[model samples]
Target chain A: MSSAVEEKRKHQKAQKKADRDAALAKKAELNMTSLMDIFVNVLIYLLMNYSTSPVDVPQSKEHTLPQSSTKLEVKHTTTIAVTKKIIMVNRKKVCDVVKNTVDPSLKKDKQASSYLITPLFKELKEDVQKQKKIAKYNPSAAFKGEVTIVADQDMSFRLLSEVMYTAGQAEFSKFKFAVVKKGG
Target chain B: MGKKIRQEDATEEINIMPLMNIIMLLIPFLIMSTEFIKIGVINVAAPKIGGGASSSEPKKKDEKPPLNLTVSITEKGLTILTRGKKIPEGCDLKGEATEAKLPTVKKIGDKHNLPVLKQCLQTIKEVFPDERRIIIMAEPEIRYSIIIDVMDHSREGKTADKDMFPEVVLSAGVL
Candidate 1:
């Protein structure tokens, strides 16, 4: 009779332990606060490291760049185009008032277009300053306030050197020279 | 109230100690293995005047004679000048008796051939084994790769010889 009574007591204790484990498992399944905290932290990391551009180039027919294999699709806020015979500062053909290509001998001949580089240089300087102003308003903006030059492959080094000198005079130290891969 | 108390006791706090330990170990490992690029260079000296061109001064009979090798690259072909004269015929591109040169037709790898410029450097390597220094005045319009190839051929087979390594100085001028 005593043995039977002890067995009944052990069976009741085991049933209570099984009920406690099932209730704990159900509580864990419903508690989503910890998982939500982990997800929020991951989302924050992704947003902070994302490469977002503040100034994107608007679609325009005037800015058709020559295709190049080495050309990186850069989101430049300030762009300058130095064509075969003309210099385009901020999409305006300021180098040549007319549609004539830049003639290298014009500098030697003392043409009016050669001296117009001073105003072009001033415009480039102002564009860089404006980029900095826009970036200042937003801390997340990665604008370096630099200008990208798109030059023709056949352009003489002497002409290219002049552009470099003007950019240097305007205090724009960062430059990326675009070139197509050889044999491309 | 009883159920809420049980839930609080069952869950433990998230541990960040192991993550921090791994990051600390990784930072030091990266710092230790970082490598910087190294550039190689060599110092050079010009040879002294001897029994060659400036013969106006008196000569020393007991001194060792200096070897004079002339390496020229013309529009026509290469010309090797030794002892102040051209080598024998059949070596020049035009087969002229006045010009000492190699067959301007040798290929670089079946694609690029040694132009008159490269042939001049190679001929200099063969004739005067000791005269390893050369001055090349090339045309401005010649491709930069052609100039580099001439310098490369200057010390071709004997690059590791240390003594025969040629020192070729290049300059650009109007042809």
Candidate 2:
């Protein structure tokens, strides 16, 4: 038979260890409800904004396009982006825009007041010739004289007209403006 | 006191393990495939420098004179003109008139009165139902959004069956 004192000591040690283990378990329990709520909300928001579009117009704070309800789909063609500080043809920087106008040094004949952007025109002409050459070689890829203009919403009509006129001079007959489609 | 339950009990009110797994797989997939800003296109006529459309010039005497509908957007407001003459605000487009009042639609509280412009165009559409082409001209300082807004207002009515003008010819401001 075991002594009463020895039995009492053994029971006391077992109870203390059980209590410590219970406290540790309680402390380790994690509440996952709040984390799950946040994730679900974010997922729902992202899902709502999903769309399948082919036109990959680079969007930034300074290069936002005007919104419109036109049902016209964006056709892939030569792209000319007119941002706040620069003008790009087919994602290649051609000239700089200062105060909503092409740089004077980049104008035709280097005239400060001339609207024809010489650098832009030259870049567009090169693209046109390349497209014509490709069309000549391959009957399937014919030159359509189409160009997409992705311009900032607040862009001045003067700059837009200059770009349009310069593009026309470069022999791009069909013109299309890239816009953010609304009313979806 | 926060008590830890015994090991062998139901864990949650609703099991979300499957949902979490699906979300983990979908979030990245959707992020790659989605276009947050839907990009579209609006076709506009290119500005021709020398000469354009001999048919509209009316060289032959028997050829009917073109209506030549044009909307000029200025800092003040939108002005609808046909055949080099302005159509008065809230007035009808006569297509061809010898002497008509000045045609200008005043802005409504620093904004172009688009509804009034649409009403005026509706009256003009009645006269020239077959005419689909219209020229748009904007001043140098005019914002590009205003031009797009005006085009939207002039392009269609409440329904698809009632299209106002789809053929938009952009003028180089001088024309």
Candidate 3:
């Protein structure tokens, strides 16, 4: 009788071990099919929207760009932004544009002969010199003298022309106006 | 032989678990780095300084000079001038023509006339398909934003689905 009781206890122990082993195996098997499906969808969406162009101008509250239906792609270049009250180059304030006109103090040349703003011209000239020096060492990269202007819509053409003229004097001949894409 | 066959089958099953792990990490990285705002550009050439003639060809006595399209922005509305002559009564945006000069007070809803100016430009574009240059004249008090909007309309005829005048020359309104 004791032998039979021992055999029955051993059988119970084996069954409990089997049950625990089965539970662990079930827990270890992770179904990654759903997770993979989600990842693939997200990857495709991001890849579709990815832009190969290098220029990425950050928009701010003070300087809102005008909307347009142009399809020209913006390339990476030096940026000159004209806000309601100030003019900036690469996020640095070069001078002030007050009430649709460049500040009188900043004007070096008379309005009739030249529209080049003094402080802006000096700053842009330095930037061009620095870029040219960098291009000398890096043979693969060349300076294109390209610049983008981001000006507030409410500002006058006088300010825009002054900024463009100053940039031209600084050896920046190519001009591009940064605008928000209309519709989508 | 049976054990060898089983080993070959196991090797044939590609271990994609590592690839899946890498993809999972890349998705979040790309999502964070992606930019939302789409930026575009309008290429513009600087205005020429002097009025020197480019062509050396001798002028004919009866040959009419080429039409120079100029859109002047005033306080009342837009005035479309072609070769110094105003086109017609339809180009005016204030519902009536006002001969107001510069430093005139900008009225509300004055920008709504841009579409009318665009229509006039479209007709001119149909006549001269190759003409891509336009002179934009604005008052000193005119906002920069309005000038941009005018350029946007004059640069391309959106309704006509054609390039009207992409070259814009900025000038002060003298009339």
Choose 1 or 2, whichever is better by DockQ.
2
State which docking tier applies to candidate 3.
acceptable
lDDT of model number 3 = 0.72
Q: Which residue pairs of candidate 2 clash? A: B87-B103, B88-B103
Single out the weakest 10-residue window by summed lDDT for candidate 3 chain B: B48-57
Q: What residue pairs clash in candidate 3, if any at all?
A: A153-B144, A153-B145, A154-B144, A154-B145, A155-B144, A156-B144
Q: Candidate 3 residues A68-181, lDDT tens each?
A: 777888887888888888888888988877776776766875453357788888888889888889999996667777788877776666667677777777777667888888
TM-score of each: 0.31, 0.77, 0.72
Off by over 4 Å in 1: A1-71, A97-116, A142-145, A179-184, B1-175
List per-prediction Cα lDDT, in the order shown.
Answer: 0.45, 0.81, 0.72
Residue lDDT tens for model 1, A25-86: 98876444565556556544544444343222222243323332221334454556666455
Considering only chain B, report the TM-score of model 3.
Answer: 0.63
lDDT tens digits, residue span B20-102, model 3: 98997887788766767677888875554411222123544645565777877777767676776665555432233445431
True contacts kept of each: 0.00, 0.70, 0.54
> Per-residue lDDT for B70 in model 2?
91
Please, what are the lDDT tens digits per residue for candidate 2 over residues B108-167?
778999888888887788878877778898888888899999888889865777778888
Candidate 3 regions exceeding 4 Å error are: A1-30, A84-86, A91-93, A96-104, A109-115, A130-145, B4-17, B48-66, B91-110, B158-161
Docking class of 2: acceptable
